[model samples]
Target: MNLLDVRKRSLGVSFNTEGQADIYVWSPIAKKVALVLPDKNKTISLAKEDMGYWHTSTTDIKPGDLYKIVLDDDLERPDPASLAQPEGVHGPSQAIDVNTFKWTDSNWNNIPLEDYILYELHTGTFTPEGTFASMEQKLDYLKELGVNAIEIMPVAQFPGSRNWGYDGVLPFATQNSYGGAEGLQHLVDACHQKGIAVILDVVYNHMGPEGNYLNDFGPYFTDKYNTPWGPALNFDDAGCDGVRKYFTENLLMWFRDFHIDAVRMDAVHAIKDFSATHILREMKMCVNELMQQTGRTHYMIVELDLNDTRFINPLEEQGFGMDAQWVDEFHHALRVTAGGDRNGYYSDFTGLQHLAKAYTDAYVYDGQYSPHRDKIFGIKAENNPGKQFIVFSQNHDQVGNRMLGERTSQLSSFEMQKLMAGAVMVSPFLPMLFMGEEYSEPNPFLYFVSHTDPELAEAVRKGRKAEFAAFHAQGEAPDPMAEDTFNESKLQWELLNQDPHQTMFRYYQTLIRLRKELPALRQLNRKQVEVVPNEEQQTLVLHRWHDNDHVVCVMNFSKTAQQVSLPSYSDSLTKVLDSAAPEWKGPAASPDQADSTSAVTVQPESIIIYTNHA
Candidate 1:
């Protein structure tokens, strides 16, 4: 999946300098294959090649030309490796020349995972226009907010327009509704120019239920294992080499072609790969080679329910070699402590001690009893640095999957919200902020999808309601097929300039700045961090330091004012940042000053940060 491997392949339509193109496709079941060039109004029968691959070279094809492949001279299908599906999934495929577009980010070096301050956003709902170009305009604002990287939800082509992008069918093509491939490249270029790395969330577990034509081409799916979305992909089954190559090439395309700094593989636990070399390991080796050649740091983060460190451990240690994985244990514990709605998975987490456990260890349920699942869950994430886990109080799944799609800002009090923010930013693990979290945007992130098929749309609606039945929310879930639902998810950008919203925004800005300015706060080593929680007082003190430098974050999870004591340390602790300060629109109840040996009175459900200054 490197440039050399890409140059050797004839798959898709690769245009050359002589105005000629080489097209290659692998369809084992087909007896006849013909290149149908609608732009030239001609059809050329392709010659059969080795390994069920059909190939044809001709000068008739050009960039932006519409084409399809004819099977047995009767049925025509879009290219399985289509670069641009601007005219929807069922429409004719458009040939796009990726090399033609000039890139301005040749000198861009990607930010490492250790320094990552990720802001997760959905392209369609991030801005009012809901396009990549509109997202490009907001790069400066994100830069000012101190976010070093942006983790975008999938942009791969899905059915109709309004989706979470999880149901993407076309791996190569960017979502046409989000400005297609060129727009994505432009957005990536703009982000790189402003020192912001782009981490794309990709769905490799299963394709969407609609517009999935891979089965028509070959055995891209298998009946061996069933997935939540559909049949599992053919990773270790027959004809899996080609399927693995297809996905591996797609990963390289994002990194090499689109200049994406990283990729967050969605729901990796669902991808059942039993091969000797797992698909993730293959991807890791491929990405590592690309990094060595390009001298750019590219990360491969995965979303897995399993808290196994093998995913992020070193390859020499017989591991998968993934850069990092999403940690949901912290979010669940924080949600339960902050008085948020606890249902289903939230039932397993309780009390302020759970939060402390998540801080000391990456997961609270590491090989522990889980009442929710009625069994033991998760393995110890040993030998892995805390940076290998991405922690957040709220994400797309935690918010949009709810019946009301209420965010943490809506679920908890203003002081509780500040406390959660303090815990996430100062924690040892990497931090991710959901879109509009900085300003606490009032709008909800409803689950919306615009499917052309009515039957499928109705099924999705019913499924969503059934998923949230256990939460026992007040009213019925919003209709996923409603255009209003998608519209309601858009961020209210103007609120950042308003009264309380502006204060919340400043609070986040200050926290991010402090996280970056302090060297002791940047380390992700759990051994360097200490967490002490008082069950009776419901207060948690997170202390992270290196050598003589120390930063302590004291959080009161109680609903009323309380005096939280601190044990004496090597140096006196002075107040550095207080979430209850008058400037941050708090109750202005913070103590005047503090020493490590004394106690400080904290307002209801607030956070106070102190540092040991020599």
Candidate 2:
């Protein structure tokens, strides 16, 4: 059966042809199930059907009506497939007709994954209002910034307003605080109109601790394995079909109903499934079917720490057909090269050499022994295309998980921040910019949450403390439950009008424009790229070519200026951009031109770009 037909026949609330509410739920353990309408003070018993399913249709209920499911006339809970939770996670699920939204993106075909310049943002802290409406107001700003795609953090309904969004409980319900279901549709439709694609982050490995009633309905979790968050989802257990179907429906709901162009699955490595057909492969097959049926393109990107290329490999080769994945190795190596502390995971990376490896090969630990992991970790991704990996210098986890939550702007000098931006933009892999990285926003992206349960809140605080025990000498971690922590993480939008921030913003704009327009940089063919690392001088040179077009990027990570030899590919190379030039307020300007015969003096902690055509 098709995904829509399957959803309508066996899940929460779907309207029938006669305009009545058709309710279905899966509960093998419930001897009796009834629909309870608290507002109307009414009860309707559902008839038990095959395969642990219950069914009932009612003319009294309509869209916007709040209702709950009562199991065996005892425990009451929200619908597992709820489209809207107007109240909080603990409240009743509201019936929402997703087709009501008037979409204006009929001609909006999605951009190719190769052309994507993604900007990752947390909806809650991207703006002061922290709602879908507020986010829509900044589409023009993002468009001007040259990012064709925006990857929003998870919006699934959590316990309260303030959260990093990983604590989401209801996978189908939109966060009521963020304007709920209709609000998200409006934002997505607006984004499409501006020639931008929206990618939503989703978590399926584990549900949140509070208000998670999936176990009360059926065997949605398994004791066979555990996740850091909580009990692992029952993807391979006896009743695994119901659990798999539940998430498969959620995946389709975002693309089919909400019109999301892509989904960035959060932490697929944490999902434990020993089944012959892995859950990720199953989901990819379903997505392929949906894409064929709709005649539109959609993608599934994953946040995976495992350097396994099997996840992104083609399904015909007995692998999961994921379009792309975030590569954290690039971030670690780049940070260490920029003089970051060599502690924790940073200890595994040895500065310039590892960074150069990440440029050529997608994984720094590809089939190599890892001292930090105490064993050989990660298979080689040598055969994977460059577009299959996304690289970034700073992201939410890289910043927020720290004790101080210090951003690259807070840790490095102005020159170093610009160098990091150039490093990411010049790589062969797809590049992503965190919320305020373009303008060098000084505020920290700290971890924050607002759970109604005090014990759970305290537990989160203690967990943060324990996670950062290595940095105990720095200071006590901020209280995650405090409102101030969330407020402090908000992006300082006004900083763009200031000094170095304005210069940094212009630098990023130019870099993105160059990446889009330059033939050598725009092409993502890894075979045409060469990275030469000079460990002695703490510098690296990246050379890229497409057809006859050639460009070179030289990055100096040292504390002093270094004389670097130019490549012999072209007789004369013209300077395109200099991060150390007077326009960007650097210490001093470097030579504007260089050839194979003459060495160029590169400024300390800066990047200079040269092109053959110029």
Evaluate all candidate structures by whole-model CA lDDT and list the values in order.
Answer: 0.86, 0.91
lDDT of 2 by residue, 36-132 (tens): 8899998888998877788888887888889999999899999888888887888999987787789989899999999999999999999999999
Error of 2 at 121 (Å): 0.4
Clash pairs detected, candidate 1: none
Kindly report which residue stretches of model 1 are placed more than 4 angstroms away from their true locations once superposed: 1-10, 469-473
Q: Predicted candidate 2: what Cα RMSD to the true structure?
A: 1.4
Candidate 2 residue spans exceeding 4 A from truth: 1-10, 16-18
- lDDT digits (tens) for residues 494-525 of candidate 1: 89888788999889999999888777788777
Error of 2 at 552 (Å): 0.6
The weakest ten consecutive residues by lDDT in model 1 span 1-10
lDDT of 1 at 110: 83
